[model samples]
Target: MRFRRYLDILFVFILFTKTTFAQGNSCTDDSTAGPDDPHSFDKAFDADKGYGYVVYGDLYRFDCCGTVKRWDFSIGDNGKIELQIWRPVDKKGKIFKLIGFNEYTVTNKNRKSGFVTFDVPDKERLSTEEDDVIGWYAPGDSLIEYTDGTSYDGIWKVAHDDNLKVGDSVDFSGGLDQGSRTYGIQATLAPNTAPKFDPMPDKKISMDINVGTTIYTVKVDDADPADVADLKMEMTTKNDFFMFNTQTGDVIVQSTITVPVGGQTVTLDFKVTDHCGAEGTGSLQVQIDYVGDPNTTPTTTKAKTSKTSPKVKTTITDKTTTDVKTTKETKITETSVAPVATDKNTDKNDKTTAKPDLSTDQDPSNGTMSAMTGGSSVDAALIGGIVAGIVGLIIIIVVTVVCVVNKKAKVRPSGKDPEKANNASKDNAKNDAKDKPSPTDKKPPSDSKSTMNGKPHVKDKG
Candidate 1:
């Protein structure tokens, strides 16, 4: 008893799983709107259609989550046809009752032939099994026929039945059909699904590619079994250099994609709609990088250096040397050499001393001592020549004065005439005294100072 109970539970679980799976996988059926018939019965007889009933069963099995939306059935009479679901009485689907319908009607006028369609109510869903029956009823003067045959037999009724059972045998004696009915059932399904890209790997593109080149072709699909009706792609950010083809999901390079950064990513959203008008969205990412051309060799740009401007650099170096020479000795030496009289004199000295002018160009590798030494030598030679020239001029002037004095001495009278000599000497002395302005000389007022015996005396006032 325990084993049987477990088995039963397992069966129920399997059945529930099957139902859920079927509902989840539901799709729009495309095969002629109805189930296929394995047998064929091309009969050409019109049934007496005065409020008659005919019931047909599907040859194949039907799963759950099926909705009968509309149907297509052909008729030869100018009348109406009514359709309903057959509620099953047992698991075998051998007995049923006409319990569910919503008064869907089809009117035919003047031999209206070919398949005519009528919409069913939304609430009416068909929970069916293999070879389950679907019933149809027509008013008077209407015509219906069997277009195909199946291995299984169908039921027929001249009048309505609240509850009906599929009996063991059916003969023409009981007025029942022997083949499958020709009708189209349009069943729609609701599936839980979304759209997705066809699992594309990430894409990469080099910055050197030309504009309008196809980056890659992307494809989108609906997870449901129905056909995707509309497909489109949109970029998250608008880029002037890139384009996306909405219909085909092809990302193309419209213009140059310039990036200051080396690498980046472009993203887009993709949407697809199934035939049932359900939409789904997904995302696509594309990586972009600055890559050189594959066919050409890459080269690097070098920075500009001061080595290129030699003149400017040399001037700067010279100024730097000048800045370093702040010592007192260097200053004195430079100051002494700075007073150059002429470039010609400087050149002559340079030749004589075998020393180049300090201002002239020299080996840049030489230190500052070379320049300062050359300058000091030139200055010393210049100062010595000036000093010697001044000393010689002074000596010539002194000798000329001495010679004149000697000549004057020789030209003087002899000492034989003593008195005359003495007078002359006294006159000369007086003249000399007048010219020299001796300290004893006084200004004559009303009374003047008189000298006696060669000595100065004060004159008294009387």
Candidate 2:
């Protein structure tokens, strides 16, 4: 249990434990807390089977691996012992729990009788790191001294109102009391405070990475909860691609990883240890990029011929009328200005506008063409200069509305001569729209009507 908040939230700094402690130095296992080492007949339990319960008491560890901060028990038994420190998530001795705790009480008195020691402070110290142990609890029998056979590693007991805090997680290694003997349990080491990481950055692998994929989680940063509780994903150089997690530094993708084509790289290297051996390294890379022959068909890249795109297109077809350009299918071509226009004077109503649709608006690869000549036909000088500028603007609006209706019929008799109607409107505006009336001498109209009789000098302002 992350040592019950010994440090979390991405640890920032703190590397202090430079060894130093002296209650009988040399790593103290016997710094004296005696009454001749918890034995008044060495029977803290099995008191002839009146064995009350709740107690783990002995297993111990402290072969110099650091910081226990003092503990040296021996007890007589008034009650209340609590001094746990289990940290053993399987170093092979099966499972174990409770991270670090400390309490101490003993009043009245009875049995073995003797020292006590304690100090523990630095926030419940006890951070052994390798098989770590050193237990004790109380709610019954005398309180110290045990000595039976031997197997240990797990031991549950509960109920003094369910007590066993600090993330309680026991196993008891299946009891029948295979053994239990730890006279005045001890621990005092001191130096051992490493573990760091939170500065990694060398990963670079954007996208494609198959085989079971997970890729990276490790962040580690510290203040020792026994150094970020159990972390250890070391891989200085091992490959088959990936697969981390030596106690959650997670990292997966175990194989089939590649990088070698038009562009390539590979990398990998790793490290992040913690059970007191301390480490923190990184790298990952990957990078690759080929692309060619993706099923062989992706080559569209010719776009550099610009001098104003639109090399001529206007194709408006449809046999229309008075330039009416209609024709959702049109016909009625008896020319010579409708020369007796047959099909019963074929005039199913004419009048129309809007153009474009010369078979898909020109250039179906040719037709009214001009894809710079690659599309053929129809460019007879850009359609004869756009049909002679729309037939000279429809013959000057039909000879200025027929000389303003023949000069308004000689000034309508006397709506005032007004200087002889301004000199007959300047001689009927120089009368000359080819003297009017000529659809080859008129007669054909009626394609339902809308014909300048087919371009009579192009006059059909209607």
Candidate 3:
């Protein structure tokens, strides 16, 4: 069943004609078809196969599919030839239907002796799948060729009927005549039509397509699959990078392509032969867009960090041959120096003390002094020293507060006997002075004042 569908037509325009710009190799072949080269021998069938009977010496297939343009045969004598063609249905073949038949009067000039031609302008197409029996008989003389060897199955002869039409199935079961023979018969073939490319006339690609990439697999739109190999292609490349793999029809990049600095267009030209005697030309374009190269090495510079440490130096002066003493007030001075520097030479008599490197990153692996280079150990020592100093200060404050409280408790509103308290205070004062550091210690000089009452007093040096 056939159904037709209609659509709402859009605005349409008409194109008059098409003109092809360029072309490639044309489909052109001038050769004869037979079991072997018919020209290689000159022997002819000198005997007649009788009138009113038909014979066929052609039953093999010609692999290259094309159109049978003409018929050729040789005759040594003047005769009449009735050509017959039977279409094959299977390998065994049949004489059921007739597709072609023609009668030709052979004379010395038109159909000559050695080899002659009978043009079949209709150009009956040849099939690669099966063979067409080209049989002919002579009501006067059927001139055949005597080749040295015969085909697998020799020629067959069958009785002819004048009433048989083109579509009538004629029975040849009882009319078979097998013989070792050959015909002067021959035929010429040419391409039926022009072939085209499957993918339009152009292909577009990118510069990013790497080498060895199958850019576009070549394909053709042709009617005959058996004649595909006979179609030749001509490819022209502006860039040597591209090539076609003939065996596989793959267009590949064989090497690198020189791309422009920015976006640009590059093209490769190609052409192929059609099934007919014509050419089909096409082109492939490549678009190159430059980004950046990853092969360039970058330079970098590292920043050097400089560190400083506070340097502390203690000096014993001539005024203090003994240990220095802390009075009511203490003074501190700090000095800073550059980071630790490596020394090739050392002063054996040096007495200066260097502080621990608190910023060192590596674990100490040497002696106990080196162990202090770690940040954790140095921080702990500093915390311990500060705590000890605080404890000593608290003890001094408690002692001073107790002395003041004792002096207040001994007071009796200035009415009790002052001599008893006075004598007890002198005794306490002598004991308190004994607990203090020796006077020989280097203590800052200050004025000392005493009161005549039975109470203690402090002297200010400000």
Task: Report backbone clashes per prediction.
Answer: 1, 6, 3
lDDT of 1 by residue, 25-111 (tens): 343443222344212222442555544443554532234323355554544544555554553443333345543343444455424
Compute each candidate's TM-score over C-alphas. Answer: 0.29, 0.28, 0.32
Cα lDDT tens digits, model 2, 179-226, are 344355555556655555665455555324456777666666655554
**Two-way TM-score contest, 1 vs 2, winner:** 1
- Alpha carbon lDDT of residue 300, candidate 3? 29
- C-alpha positional error of residue 277 in candidate 3 after TM-score superposition, expressed in Å: 19
* C-alpha lDDT of residue 12 in model 3: 12
User: How big is the positional error of residue 205 in model 2, measured in Å on the Cα after superposition?
Assistant: 6.8
lDDT of each: 0.45, 0.47, 0.49
- Candidate 3, 231-250: lDDT as tens digits: 77767665676888756768
Error of 3 at 376 (Å): 99
Off by over 4 Å in 3: 1-32, 39-59, 94-96, 110-112, 122-129, 194-462
lDDT of 3: 0.49
Give the candidate number with the greatest TM-score: 3
Order the candidates by lDDT, highest first.
3, 2, 1
Q: Of the candidates shown, which would achieve the greatest lDDT relative to the real structure?
A: 3
Better of 1 and 3 by TM-score: 3
